[model samples]
Target chain A: MIIEGRTWLFGDKIDTDVLAPGYAMKLSPEGLAQHCLEAVDPDFAKLVKPGDIVVAGANFGLGSSREQAAISLATLGVGAVLAKSFARIFYRNAINIGLPVVAIDLTQEVAPGDILKLDLAAGTLTRLKDGYHRELQPMPPHIIDILEAGGLMAQLKQKRGL
Target chain B: MPQTLTQKIIARACGRTTVKPGEIVTVNVDLLMGQDASGPRRWRPRLEELNAKLWDPSKVVVVSDHYVPAVDAQSAEILNISRRFARDYGVKNFFDMQGISHAIMPERGLLRPGMFVAGGDSHTPTAGAFGCYAAGFGATDTTAIAITGETWTTVPETIKVQIDGALGPEITAKDVMLWLCREMGMENSFKSVEFMGSTVSAMSMSERLVMSNMAAELGAEAGIIGVDEITIEALKATGGDYEGAEAWVADPDAHYYKTVTLDVTKLGPQVAAPHAPENTDDVGAFAAVKVDQCYIGACVGAKLEDLQMAASVLRGHRVSPDTRLLVAPATVRVTEQAAADGTLATLTAAGAILLPSGCGACAGMGAGIIAEGEVCLSTTNRNFQGRMGHKDASVYLASPYTVAASAVTGHITDPRELRTSTRNAA
Candidate 1:
């Protein structure tokens, strides 16, 4: 999928509490989508458009591995996540739920609210306004296979010819 | 290539002889877990989205202790979701508000040595207490574990923390951890830490469990207390069939990326300052700091010993009118035992409000919230900015002794002074 959005840049260790506050933990996935980043920036939910990408530094999704962090971002219409590194659980959860996560070398060249374009299949990232190009390590064949199958359950179903 | 704990565990799970750092490999999971707050939301949706029939329902465990008995409608809703999810999935291992997920998992034999356990909560690394290469992952990772029972991970290098010397009075495992948090700060990111040496050997499993459980807050993948007789006894208490459980230890010549020594004798009661668990200072340095509230609960503080400590200081005393004291047990069983022992009576008579066994104030889900400019001395983890209540409110982290003393005095007072007060009363 070709995705484009204004990048929401965050520094290292953006834990689950910031992504999905404990107070709102009771809300449905759709409800959580509306409150994403309410702790860090109140207007983040309203400001984000569909197909937008969130770029964060190392240890993104660092604290509690609640998949809600990924599901909330996904249901909020986050097109992709680009980070320097991801906590193991968050990374797996994002991909399993059909959210594309790319680990790219973060540089000072990108700033918050910078419009960027990502081609998941091509493994290419481009800052739309600045014309900056950065290539990311693409998902391997097996991971892409899992994604195309729409997660592990679907992959199993397909393998069984169901 | 040097083998790390992550490498060794992943390799065995993947059926490989060896794996290197930064190399990705998808390995099978021996156990999967989720707590009340995160499980229902993530697992139910993923289960539906995938449309897969539940595998062995017993392999999955749902715990509802974060806000058991429901703190508010939100917490209540989450609890309902967890119960409904567990029932529908036929999950026989649902721990309904029984206790902290980590504390209960071992008690139920869900954690095994040399097994790969994944949980949706950060403290899942608590399984490492039993030599399981357990670690916490985000919800998405849990979805994978729930569905495929496997995940890809990069191996981490090991860091050895050697402990020696006996603890002095008032020194406890909690003090050892807070000291590490101060010494390591956030610089401890993404490493495996193992506790070894004579001092570690002398510690009880409960004490070691406390140390390993908080390792996540330090940014480490997992913390391990080397297996010993104490571990065997703990396993036995939990009905663990130790028929084939192998004992493993770090080799005398094993490699570590870093080595830090902790002399428990030198450590004192530590307090995490406002906004950061890592911003810890010795209690004597900040004894005069006042508080508006005092809370002792969460997995860290609800231990029976913790309550006894609080009760000893609070007996025949009253709480400060300005300072509210809330004590939540970690489990219903804990509440029952304390009530039977009259610890509950002493605490309630001292004006300490007894909340149910749930996460409560630790996660700021229910009572004990402070107003703007108010400060609270708490026995929970993470004093992160605005974590306890209003962003402007301050939270000071301390042990039950400090929290109880502060509750009675309306200001933070050392437990040593409480002893003096008791002497005067006699």
Candidate 2:
């Protein structure tokens, strides 16, 4: 599977509080998405287009186990996230919700709004702007299966014949 | 084969004699915990959609700490849904407004050593103080575990954190953790951190809980300390099973991805400035920073021992007229115990306003939250931006001792200075 999107840049330790602020947690998914990353980038939710890719520095989504942090981004139509690293729970949370998360340091190479293409099966990401390419370790088959089945909930529904 | 304590517990859960790191395996969960925000309020809809019932309600524990005494209609509805979920599912261990789930689980003897536990909140590793292989998961993963009674894990390589020597007076586990946040950094993902050494062994259950609790801040899968006499005795006192609990210790030759050691004899009280837990410095460095609020609350910092630490510092002193102090015990039991021991009296006499037993103000919810441009010195963990209130509010993380001392001075004062001055006067 291949994904293409414009890049949106963020910095190191972009914690869960920024991704889904605690004060806005009581809002609905759509409402919460409007406040996503509002602490750092007030225009993020409004300006972010569907199929946009978030490229961030290390330890992205570093605090809190709130799945809403990932949910807000997915709700805003973010196609995938590429960070230098991620907090373990957030990584799994994103995958469980059918959001693709990749680990690669592209903060220096890619500018905001630069279109990028991700080949999930091939484990390759190509910078459409400069034709620069980087390889990432392919996800395990079981994880891929879960992603293909549209996340863990969907996979579970399939197993139960729902 | 030698195995880390984490591996031993996971192997038991998976019905295997041994397991290796990096291998994915399905393990039966001994207990599953969740609180209002991440628990039933989110699970109910998905469970209904899947037409599923809880695999075993007896193994599930739910708490209403997050939205307790709901401040708004939305929060009230969330709490109501949590209550109805427990009733409909026949979840016997449901704890409504009983304080944080991390403190409630052990207080009720629901956790046992060697158990494979999953919680729906990040601080769930607090149970690792009892030697359980406890880790936090997202709502969806927790929902899956609720339905299946099992979950998959990619076994994590263990990072051994060894701290030797005694903590100086006024220095507590919170100080050690703040220092570790800087030493280890918050990027050790996909790893389990086991804290051990004379320092951890000598720590009370409350202090040990702090060490394991902050392992989340270190970005570890779980923060654990091997079961010892203190653990066994605490379990026995709490009416939990302690039989063979001491066998949960890690083998001496167990493989570790890395071992980080610290000698705490010379360590001073540490504090982390706002925006990140890893941004730590000695308490003295922040001495001139005045605070608007001094809060001692949350699952990690509002236990009986933590309350006692604050009370000791505030025994004959009053909170600064310039700064307000809020004290929220971790649970009803902690409050009862503190009240019985005069700890509550000492705190209140110091002009400390008592808050309800819940995750108040710590999760940027409920009461006592700061406003824009306000600053707070907090005993709770995690001072991430917008965590405890307005985005512009600055928070500094410190031990209860430091928080109480700072409350008296209206600035980030080291507890040692106050203790020394008090002793000199006495």
Candidate 3:
């Protein structure tokens, strides 16, 4: 699978609270998406375009097991998330919800608005601006299968003939 | 092959004799728990869309705690949906407006040894105190578990934490967890944390639950403790079956990815400052920070024992005029127990306002939330930015004893110092 998008840089420990703030939890998924990253950068939801990629330092999506954190990003059409590391639940939540997330260190090399391309199957990332490339650890086959099916629910639906 | 308790539990659930770390396996879930915010309120629509029903209603437990007592129209609607989901699904173990799901699960004898559990909330590892492999999952994963009675997990390596020596007066499990959060950074993802040693063995099930609950703050997949006589006794007290509980112990030569050892003899009451649970230090380090509110609530705090800790410090003293004290028991049973034992009386006599039993204020929902620029010393687990209220508000984490002591002084104060000073004055 290939994904291309402009990059949005974030720092370490970008927790679920900022990604989907508690105050906006009661809103619809789209309304909640409007408040995504509102605490850190108030303009994130308004400024973010479809197919934009989010790159962050270690422990992205660190707190809360709310799937809305991942849904908010997906709702805003985030192409993929690349971080140095991720909290276990958030990583699973993102994948289960059909949001592609990768654990790779591109925070230091990638800057905001840098267009990048990701070949998930090949486990490689490329900065379109300068042709800078980095190898990424490939996801497991089962996880890839789920993502290809557009999430666990979709995969389950397909398997059950529902 | 020798296996850690976590591996043993997973092996049993997956019907495997052995499993290795980093291997993905789909394990049958023994029990599934969900709260108002993450469980039914979110799962209802997804389940409808999938045209699916619960795999087994008896194995599921639902609780309405997050938006209980109808704070507003939206919250009231959320609670209503949770109720409808429980009834529509034929879930017999539904707990309505009962308290936090973590504390309520054990109180009702739902958790048992060697069980593989999944909970909707992040603090689900609190069940790990019962010698189970209970880990938190997001709504989508939980929904999948609800439909199939199984979910996949990447087997996690175990990180053993051994604590020795007895806890001194006023230094409770909350302090130890705050200390652990700093000592072991909150970046330990994809790992299970197991607590062992003389100290853990001597602790009550309540204290052990606190240790496992905060494993989320440590960023661990699950926090577990080996089952012992204390665990058996607690299980019995709660009317839970404990047959074959002794078999859940880890092998003597089980391998651990890492081992951390701590001696509680010299450890002081610890505190984590604003913004992060990992930003911790000795209680004295935060002495100069005056607090506008001292809150005791959440699954990690406000248990019966936690309430007793606060009552012990507030028995004869009063909350400072400058600071307001709020105590929201974790569950209704905790409230009843505290009231029956005079713990609630002691707290209220000291000017502590009691809120309804729920995850109030701790999750930045419900009552007692602080305003911008105000400071609160809380007994809850996480204190991340804007978790308890305004983004500019500062929330500090500490034990119930320290929170109660600070409530009395209007500043961050050590519980031991207040105890000594009270004796000195007497």
Ranking by DockQ: 2, 3, 1
Q: What is the TM-score of chain A alone in each candidate?
A: 0.90, 0.97, 0.98
TM-scores for every predicted model: 0.88, 0.99, 0.99
- Displacement of the residue B113 alpha carbon in candidate 1, Å: 2.6
The Cα error of candidate 2 at residue A80, in Å, is 0.2
- The C-alpha stretches of model 1 lying farther than 4 A from their native spots are A102-107, A119-124, A133-162, B1-12, B16-20, B48-51, B71-81, B84-88, B187-190, B370-373, B417-426
Candidate 3 ranges with C-alpha deviation above 4 Å: none
What 10-residue stretch in candidate 1 chain A is worst by lDDT? A152-161
lDDT, candidates in the order shown:
0.76, 0.93, 0.93
What is candidate 3's CAPRI-style docking category based on DockQ?
high
**Model 1 DockQ class:** acceptable
Q: Which TM-score value belongs to model 3?
A: 0.99
Give one digit per residue, the lDDT tens place, for model 3 in B323-342: 99999999998999989999
Kindly report which residue pairs in candidate 1 clash with one another. A65-B137, A65-B138, A65-B139, A66-B139, A67-B139, A67-B140, A89-B138, A93-B140, A93-B141
The per-residue C-alpha lDDT of model 2 at residue B381 equals: 93
- Candidates sorted by lDDT, descending order? 2, 3, 1
Q: For candidate 3, lDDT tens digit of each residue in A77-96?
A: 99999999999989999999
